[model samples]
Target: MTQQLDFSVGMGKETTYGSPSAVTRFFESEAKAKYDVKTIKGSGLRPTKGVARTSRQSISGFEGSTDIELDAPTRGLGFLLNAVMGAVTNTLVSTGLYQQVHTLSTTDPVASYAIQEALPPIGGGASNVHTFRGCVFDSLEISAKEGAYLSVKLSATILKMLTTGATAASYPSDDTLFSFVHGSIQVGGSLTEPGATTLAVGDAIPAVNISDFSLKVARNLDKKGWNLGGAGLRSRPPVLGKPEITGKITAEYTDNVLRDAYLAQTPLVLILTFTSGSNVLQIAMPAIKLKGEVPTSNGGDVITQSIDFEAFDNGTASQPIFIVYRTADTTP
Candidate 1:
């Protein structure tokens, strides 16, 4: 019989980029671990050799990236989103027994540390566990479909990877999990329309004929220190490049509202809500500048319109994109 090798993973925010840590938070979902050993080739003529010879390649750098598919929830998903956006929550407002997710900012972001491992043996054994430090979110893709569970895919870049011989004995539990059954979309705000600046709760977009929707957030980060120093990987964090927000929507061609917005360069408001009983998660973009052309096709099933849009800031610090969730966590 083959030996069972059960794995466990944990993550935590790091104080400094490229610094290792024993992550404390555990995620109970599908996770894939990845690591790369960058090397520099030395294929040139030697001093004593007549013909060109090759020498032992030197270890140039170490980097890691991971993709995790998580169920959309209030706690872990909120935490991951805040980390990616480089935002920290400063307030939590609650009424009755529900705690409302306050304004999440993207002013200053920090890296989150993670560990990919397995449950250690009783006393002593070779443990195949790796700890990563200074991890930053590279991209996040969220998808939802009718009669399907809402899920989120998170991609991250890490600085250093340390493979320890043995790991801690136990692991944490992922207890609070939320699905996508209670998802809702509130649309009806005008883009570039006069007297329509903010969106209210009553402007709920009907989802009776909607098929699927997706939202992608990317932090176009530039990985530096690739050719720095002589030996070992560098200990500096990556520089954040231009942040981007893009998404696609698949819905029935109900009207020419979105098409009109795309043509007139209108700025629209979108509020995506996910709720599981009392727990709720909201992704609100106040000023989403429309881009690309609206494509339509007549199929045998139904008439659907698919268009792409990009989120942009309308010269405001705190009004571009807002990620609100219902949790006890005041800060992420």
Candidate 2:
């Protein structure tokens, strides 16, 4: 029997934490589910043997990751956004058009998901399905460059992995991808909550030319929250620590706006918008401080500035980071 590389990934929100949910949406992705096992060995000193004897190994827990092409899917990406951001307010903006405003939740008990990975069958053999339950995002990264599509990398901590009773993968047909051609950046914008209203056009930076950008958000979950009597699995959901939002932007060194802000320790707002037909995704950093160096010339090429930034709570906004996604999906 010859093995093939055919695989599929699907996910759905769990009604109860750690309970398996039916896969409702699929992703075009390179995804995997990993198991973490603990090995135990005898520590007693042997009289004649030189090597220690091995005892046993057992499953501890599970984790997984998915690298996805960021698409303007009407419904699918909302699950991921909610998993990371903790809360979302979805509303219908126009006829058949919906807007989802994702924000950080101050309350405990965020959303959890069940992810299924369907492995290819060996010739006529039965395909294996691995389902990861109580899946929560440990970290998420969104990045894009000129002439490239937006990409997302998600790291998740899973409570358990079940290999049985999972449905086959099926994907939606209405998803559209977001590329760099559909992207725009605005720096030093007015800090405004992206609710029903969009950002004003006059808030854009004067003449900055951005080539590439990347943003990363980490949940910093405490993975050792396991109890002694409940087996090696987590007794409760992993405790979330302070979130860290950081990113980098590469742009043509046309002016000193970014450098001057960094040198003077000034705070600024960063907004990135992407449009795919009628769908829109807008990411806003209400307060950010630049930490990158000034642009330096190298060889005869166009000078560029790669600026590092950190997002912070502006004390008035809903959260340190906000995302407004407009699509046709009515439900989150």
Candidate 3:
């Protein structure tokens, strides 16, 4: 009998674009990754009949997406972060501790991965493994609600797919998942250097009641760089275009700080941190402008404000988003 628990997702970094990489790590995901092929149909008029010909249809390319329950695994989370941010710096902090700082890359040829999804074998049949090559994240969303663990959704552009040579799935033993109780948000800080600025403990916003938050970073890749002779696949990797960073925060409407900032068009810094034991994940947006709506009442319920914000470079040389992960893992 087939079982949903038997499905697995594995990934590894690719040294070369569109090249297959060995499955080095597995993820505890919410569902199986999906890969869909793009196709094109010839529009030629056939004098033979009124029905369209099936031979005119052809494959063009592939795209995929997956959702993972975000966890602080010793060595695998950085792979997803690098796919989104394009760059990472890993440093050993102390004994059995390391810090990984992920930043946006300004150059081409960002990191790519070979992702494998293993379907549960049919009754007494071998498992089917679908490997997606040259997988680059086009967008990544990290979200956290009131009573759930942090989740990550990745939309990827795939160059090719293979369905053979299944690799056994293996998970890390030191995985620690972060929940909403382990999260905190700080807002309304000033950035001295805008994109390059780091927030200190004193920069924390005081007495802010937040219910939920989400951040989405998109690397709007140009996926139309196909050539005539490339056999229905991308001739080269998708060209990275400008990055778009946006987010939303739902918080209790207790003060006029956020409303006043929205009215005055103030530039604010927002920091979100999640901690579980010695593992910590911090996302810092150095400069952002709020587009907030006033809180309204509904049947005597507590009023809440939903604020939409966008991150920008703030005229600095550095990238707008910075993610720092402190964990015991040594490598990404």
Give the best candidate by TM-score. 2
Model 2, runs deviating above 4 Å: 1-5, 46-75, 197-202, 206-208
Give the clashing residue pairs of candidate 1, or none.
86-109, 191-267
Model 3 segments more than 4 A misplaced: 37-48, 54-75, 191-202
For residues 29-95, what per-residue lDDT tens digits would candidate 2 score against the true structure? Answer: 7556676665455556757866755443335544444444444454477767777878788888889
Model 3: ten consecutive residues of lowest lDDT = 193-202
**What are the C-alpha RMSDs, in order, of all predicted structures?**
4.9, 2.5, 2.9
Least lDDT summed over 10 consecutive residues: which range in candidate 1?
191-200
lDDT of 1 at 192: 26
lDDT of each: 0.62, 0.76, 0.76
Clashing pairs in 2: none
Task: State candidate 3's TM-score.
Answer: 0.89
- Model 2 weakest lDDT span, ten residues long: 55-64
List the pairs of residues colliding in candidate 3: none
Q: Is candidate 1 or 3 superior in lDDT?
A: 3
Mind giving the per-residue lDDT tens digits that candidate 1 earns over 171-260?
224235444557677555533211111222425454554567788888787766565462556556666677788887776777777778
What number of backbone clashes does candidate 1 have, counting pairs of residues 3 or more apart or in separate chains? 2
